[model samples]
Target chain A: MESVSFPPLSRVAICGGTHGNEMTGVYMVREMQKQKMDKTGSLSVSIILSNPRAVEACRRYIETDLNRCFTSDLLSSPVTDSTPYELKRAQELNAQVGPKGSEEAVDLLIDIHNTTSNMGLCFIFYSIDWVTLHILKYIQSKMTSVDIRAIQLDLPISEAYSLESVGKHGFAIEVGPQPNGVLRADIYNMVKEAVDHIFSWLQEFNSGSTFEGGEVEVYTLVKSVDYPRDAVTGEITAAIHCQLQDNDFKLLQRGDPIFLSFSGETVKYDDEELYPFFVNECAYYEKKIAFHLGRKIKLTFPSINLTG
Target chain B: MESVSFPPLSRVAICGGTHGNEMTGVYMVREMQKQKMDKTGSLSVSIILSNPRAVEACRRYIETDLNRCFTSDLLSSPVTDSTPYELKRAQELNAQVGPKGSEEAVDLLIDIHNTTSNMGLCFIFYSIDWVTLHILKYIQSKMTSVDIRAIQLDLPISEAYSLESVGKHGFAIEVGPQPNGVLRADIYNMVKEAVDHIFSWLQEFNSGSTFEGGEVEVYTLVKSVDYPRDAVTGEITAAIHCQLQDNDFKLLQRGDPIFLSFSGETVKYDDEELYPFFVNECAYYEKKIAFHLGRKIKLTFPSINLTG
Candidate 1:
């Protein structure tokens, strides 16, 4: 990809509790709100505690997933008709940092999330934009120990409304292995680091420096693999095969055992070797996704001069 | 304590999903149900899928904890009067396996549970009884790798009514470090072994065998310890200290750090040394319990002739 000049970001927003049980983001936002760390240098920063009620209840969401409610069509719908809890929340949130083309919109949005899967420092983006690549490169540069991977959701989900879609440059940073609603120091610190780095990068950008040359391994979503379920009962009949359990980011060869039934039956993957993430995500059980398969690709961008 | 003769067992009940997210019991029961293994020789076994709704939702309970709803006062209340979901379910359960004094009541109940804390193979009893002790001894002997500890709820909870309380002889077996709703093959096997052992022992007892001459360590609950909280907001400010996060069933000395705050402040335990279990339990967050401190003591019972 050719190096592109970054757009000036005057206003930035950090959103948390998009999925309430993902407490790493909620606590990080709470800590920042409590400390009144609203801005870095001249940039105006906004902290959003999205889905506060769900966060209080320690659930993913009260109604539909707030993340999926970010589609343009839904955003254009009248607020009076938004009866679902998350729909109303989406409207309120969009009014704050959204309506991407509007004058009041924030220049950038950072939606924080956590997962039950062992996906470490996942940078998720709706579009393969320069801003997304820059942030991924910056975060990957600093956190060498963390398994850094960029995931571009090329599925129909591109039209799926997410908190970030409302801003000019919007993306999500997901960190975990932590169970829902439980906070660990390691994850909390990682979250803080990612947020802190974003703010620091923003400050540098506002001072006329832009992230230029870098390369990152990008994993594009292939398809979601559901757990083996009983044909009649629809009940999950097997678990993620022992060999593949917790093996996020690992390459699995064709014919690899993906699930093991209670009766010792094995379900194997029969396609080409693929890199998988979100393996055995506890939260995804409701969605019936055991894991998501991804195809790996490399993205290299040349150095560019960006001024804010 | 004098060893007493084992009581004859004609009926046995294994209860699961008493706390829905504890899937070790739920899956074991499901597996057994699927296999149609309702009898261990002469004993007529019944598998109770307690709190079906909560199990379906992958939550601990829809309302209050079902385990805590077994009190006679609550059980005696009408279904309409029992406003909570669990209260109504408890009444229904009491009708089936309870009203303990009735002839139709189950003679023995084995309620299984799993914890987020690192407690391994915990045998919990409300009252001291030979049946509880012997079961503990037998399981401990068979699974030496498991940290077998007996916990007697010496608090007002002794009358808090649990599923096991309905039977003449009943106790709860808790295994953990397993997250709620997620089942591990190891924990699943452990639960099956415990149930298997109980059924075999019952079969042996019915065939005129008696248990005698055994000693086991008992950890009597002293009190629950809460995590460090903000004095003004009452919100938890710190988490279980790093040293004690998963150190369930381990001795904790006074002056040792029990919690580590976000600000890097350490809150130390100031009381006498005690054994702590259920450390950082995800479900107990609602109850504000970081862990339960216990007094460990050894109990020995002499041999006596048991009759059916």
Candidate 2:
């Protein structure tokens, strides 16, 4: 007879790379798996391949976006309603990876991906939370080249669409902008190191060692960028300036700027408040999402979207 | 390359069954191994089958009793020392099952066993810690069929002389007066449940879950039980009302009531103020030093035979 053990406590899951062309997350998972966790007594981790087929195809899910598909509400529903195939899978995944009582309990979730254009080293965006945000600095400190910054840090994510919307915290770690093959290896290591850091922390804590809590930079989404898309690329290169509507619109403060710059230049045409800072740091083409992070007070604006 | 998990928060080494005759702990290990812990999501456990050959023999050890040889001084000596083979193996086994940091990090090290006589179900003699005592109850709660009681609910364990002592918080979970084979299934399930419980508690705590700790019963040792030997059956039974002596050569206590009842009636007696509660308990008969346990207030005692 098979003996059944309770659901594990701390764990790491590798996602993305569903498209064969997208290899960052898959490679990350492999590397994470290969790394030896000598402290297994303290922590138990299992590696999950989220989209094996999509990972092979090198493109997003054929029918839908898996990321948007996964959520508690859609997953727990008895019927599909108006959800797509990927949406259904997301529901299944949420059930399997959500919390202890629900089905699968996932303490931490990591989604990896390569950017479409030249961008920063690794920029992760998630619903900044108290517990999840606790060790965010530890991750940033371990980085050598790329600076780790949270989106919405500069612009407060509105109350309506805060991190709470996403079950737990999420990290959209951009492994630099796409098109740069050389950086992929470097990106792989950077992401791997972050994952290792999380596991290491878990092992220590599991062994009864504690880390200093507090000190998490909460990123609030002020609003999104809406712009007209070029005929060729269905996606619009985010426009510069305050294009968000005030009806439910909120904008980052004068100094706090966060937005995607797609024109391939630090300077946005038609003088406007852009995710305004350009380091010319890593890559020129990397369409980096700028942010004004590290403030205490939340900047609230009416409902808003920055999708250009 | 072999993957090594993080050093476990706690290690539950299930030995015994060294002699096929006392294959109690082995049964527990088999059940624990069968338990399915969502391998990658939470805590990880490792189980090792110690003394494979001896377990098949159905004897304690080939020549020496492995339990009698775990004294630190003896273990510190050269592996090739003139110590009994049992002592040598003890040296190896102790090092293998030695502590790994935190007090409870290696918490409950249970060695399961069976007695020569088949009278009772199961009983655990722990290091007399409140946590240990509570865990004893937890074990009993999971397996209620057996009468589980701590020898020193209020006593110390330093009563026995001629023994090398280890740390407190250790235990000997005896399974019977003799093996009826039915005990194996119960032993297995008990161990599996216990392992799950401990790991789960550790997991939730590490993940910031609140847990309530409890106190338990224990004993302080005062003296040892000695009996004259037999030449044929090798079973030396203590006569009822046997007087016991302290290391100072003073008559510590007088035995009024018969201590041990082997066949149908009283076989031995105790020398304490209160009669040792025999109550048809399953016990073994052998020409060896025996230890007595009783409850005491705020007491401290050695774990094994003397050299603590």
Give every prediction's interface RMSD: 1.9, 35.3
lDDT of 2 by residue, A1-308 (tens): 12212222355554655333345566555444545432355555545556666654433554665655434444455654666656566555655555412334455565666543234444345444443443465576766566565544332322212112233444556554332111123455566677677666555544544344434433344433333344674433333322221101132345432222332223323433333222111121112322221222332222211112
Evaluated at residue B274, the lDDT of candidate 1 is 95
**Among these predicted structures, which one has the highest DockQ?**
1
Candidate 1 residue-wise lDDT, A1-308, digit = tens: 46567657769898999998888788778877887878668778898899999999998898788888888778777767547989888888888886655767898888999887778888888766677777778877887888888788873433756788778887888887777767766777777878778777777776778466877789998999998888998888777776887788899998888887776678889988899898877778778999999999988766554643
Judge candidate 1 at residue B18 and give its lDDT: 92
lDDT of residue B134 for candidate 2:
41
* Interface quality of candidate 2 as DockQ: 0.00
The clash count of every prediction, one per candidate, is 6, 86
